[model samples]
Target: MKIACLQFNPKLGEIEKNQNFASGLLESYKPGDIDILVLPEMAFTGYMFKSKEHIKPYLEDAETGITIRWAKAQAIRLRSFVMVGYPQIVKGNPDIYYNSICFIGRDGELIETYSKHFLYTTDESWANEGPEFKAINVDSLGKVGFGICMDLNRYQFKAPFDVYEFADFHLQQRTKIVLCSMAWLSNNDNYNDNDNNHEISTINYWCNRLSPLILNNNNDIGNILVVVCNRTGIEDSTTFAGSSSILSISPSTGSVHLLGSLGKRQESIMIIDVPIDDDT
Candidate 1:
């Protein structure tokens, strides 16, 4: 199966513009080409909102949100699975919201909705922490895990996140693929989206983090694939990492490689075929 990741820039609070841009992107592709399509975190809404009130205009209920409606329509039209991130105002009287990802199946059915587990301090003011992650099985994709940007980082609000380690968790679940959505901002002045070196290092950093769990000599998790959809461009002076990519690791052979990638700061849909038998 071929999976496509979308890397793009979104302006603050310009939901309609972003939606149109994303819609136009899908229009260029035939539905049967890609099995799954992933978009960056808050793909339509800019990620730098100061408060919940500041972003309320873009928030919608997970069940009936216009964002999910668009995704459902796209999935039905393209005959592919679609996953995108947006702020979800959970349906309730208290009006609770979270940084969330919604997955729509090929038949336009709501598959699964995941809230972000790890959040930055800045996110604490408006967003709530999410539930513990567990991999799920899709129609075509086998065992799959879902995650967000900060969830990759070992820390949560400056502290080590869960009690269990990353390796143990995935190993037990035997999750073969992880679909991730990210708005990975580069706050360091030393690094920007223009530098491919920094972007490569960032990928390397993730590889290193997963080394112990999926691609090491001691482990037996075969053919683990991590597919990332990260945002690009600057939002409120913070530049996002645009080197959205796929990393495949065959634990039996202990070999890891980049399957496909988009250029740093480029807006494009990258598609890569997955060799079912290869375990990196």
Candidate 2:
């Protein structure tokens, strides 16, 4: 099977422009070129907003909003399952919103949705905390779990490092694939030759956070696949770290293989061919 991570910079509040930019990135690929396509959190909508009132214009419905509309089109056009994030307005209450990501089937039907379980400072201003993390089964992929940007961090950045809440849940669920959509920021504001190294640091931190699953006792199954789709570019005072990558972890040997990755400043798609365990 093939997996793709679309890494690009999205300007604040420019949904249509970002959509076009992302679309142009995938133009070279024919239908079925990718089995699964992942986009960064708030994929087309810029990540930073001051308040609920500030983001009202960009809030979208889970099903019929402009974001989903765009995702569905990509899913159908590429003949691939698409996972992307957006700011979602609560169905019954217009006042409520969540930083959410949704999975669309190859036929462009909604498969599952997961809101951000851990809110970043920006999310706290206008989004509600989602329920606990969970995994769902999808065709070919077996069991797949989803996570937004802050979900990978230690809870509130205060939880015991060993807790590994997200990784533990997926390990318990025996998830074969973990898809993470992120708008992770660079530690430094100034971009320099060292930016690439900083992106590597972030990726290493992410892997260490999943140590529980990486160090799992189960040696019977194949390596688990984790795909992180992170964006690049600056939004106001924040500069995003864009080293989107696909990793394969061996449960038996505790090895983490980086299948492919994009640079911190590259606006491109990283595609990797992965071997799926049919019985997993």
Candidate 3:
């Protein structure tokens, strides 16, 4: 299946302008061009808001608002599934909001809405944490999983050192692809404070964080695909890491490898294909 991962920068609080930018990229491809197209977290409603009120105007009802409408419109035009992130007004509780992702099917149907189950400190002031993990089935894609930026890094402990959270879904489930919408910051974003230890690239951070699935050394059917679409450019004190990547493990060797990368600071629409096994 061919997947397009769009990595671009978004202006803070300018929903109309940002939607146009994202829409332009979606319009660049035609129908039957790709199986799925994934955009960055808060694709239109940029991250780094100063307060909850600052983002209030952009929050939409998770299922039928502007973001969903846009996704439905684009999915209809492209004849493919679309995954994007936007500020979501909780369905049953309108007073609550979350940083979330939505999956719009090729037939212009809303398939799923996944809230960020784990929140970063920066998000706490404006967003609520989601309650559960999720996996869904798409026509040609098989079972797929969803996660936002911080959801992938939900570590169990950070007391003195660090302890990783266990992610065992892929081993037992039929999920073939996992999609992550991110606005990941570059490590060097903290350089002004003179912390030399914070120089690792976010791509390295992602590769390591995905060890539970990619490091399938002893597991069979190891070819699970992880598609990440992250934003670029600097937002306030944070410079987002833009190395959107598509990585996978080789079924033959059970070793992890990079299938594609959009690089660190460029705005791009990367099209990569993942071979689907007949059995899957």
Candidate 4:
């Protein structure tokens, strides 16, 4: 199966612009050539939504909403599964919202919706935290795990870590791909007077450090493909350094291969062919 990750800068609160951007990227790919297309978290609206009242109108319902309808149409047209992130209001409390990733199948079906299991400290003011880690089965792709930005940090905990515990529990279920949708920000505060370090070291310190560690640990347990889709550019005071990538792991040896990366904070679609092991 082939996969594509879109890395681009999103305009804050500009739904039309961001949707158009995603549409254009989707149009560039050939139908059936790519099995899955992953997009970054809150791609429609920038990371900081200010408040529920401010973003209420932009929240989408996965079943019959315009965004999902458009995405499903695109998925059907491209014959590829699409994983997109957006803000969604909870049914009971209409006022409360959840950071969600919606999956659209190649057949124009709304496959699954995974709410972000871990909420960022900054997001607690507006978004409700998700309680469980959900995995979906995508026929040709085996079972796939979905996670948002802060959910990756769940691994930082020592005992009974949310992500690690989730991974341990799910390992027996035979998942193939672990997909993450993120709006990764570069740490500009740490760039003061570190002239002694190499340029690569400085870059890696802020941008690329956590990814390899996450991929390495995941690869060791099961041969899973780790794909991260991140947005670029600056929103409010935060600057995003786009480094979206795909890493493939060998089940037997746990060796990782760098499939691809989009190094700039510009619009890009990265495609890579992923071979499925029949033995699994």
Q: Give the clash count for each candidate.
A: 3, 0, 0, 0
From the highest lDDT down, the ranking of the candidates is 2, 1, 3, 4
lDDT of 3 at 175: 62
Please, what are the lDDT tens digits per residue for candidate 2 over residues 141-254?
Answer: 788999998898878878877778889888989988999999999866776533543378878988998898789868876678999999998888788888898988888887
What TM-score would every model get versus the actual structure?
Answer: 0.91, 0.96, 0.89, 0.83
Evaluated at residue 69, the lDDT of candidate 1 is: 93
Q: Model 3 TM-score?
A: 0.89
Evaluated at residue 188, the lDDT of candidate 2 is 61
After aligning candidate 2 to the native by TM-score, how far in Å is the CA of 107 from where it should be? 0.5
Residue-level lDDT tens digits of model 1 in 170-261: 76788888889998865443444455433786677667667655445545456788888998888887777778989887777677789988
State residue 80's C-alpha deviation in candidate 3, in Å: 0.9
- Candidate 3, residues 1-280: lDDT per residue as tens digits? 7888988789888878888987886676898788898999998888998678988898999778887888899889999899999999877887899889999999999899999887877788888888876888877778899988887775423522233342455545646788989988886553332221212367677766766665556444547788889888788868877778887755446466777888666666899877776222
Model 3 spans with C-alpha error above 4 angstroms: 156-166, 190-200, 278-280
lDDT tens per residue, model 4, 1-280: 7889988778988888888988887776678778888999988877877777777778877677666777788898889898889888766678668889889988989889888877776567678877788777778777888878877654433444333544443455555788889886664423222222222332343223233333444444556677888877777777665667787655555355667777645577888887766322
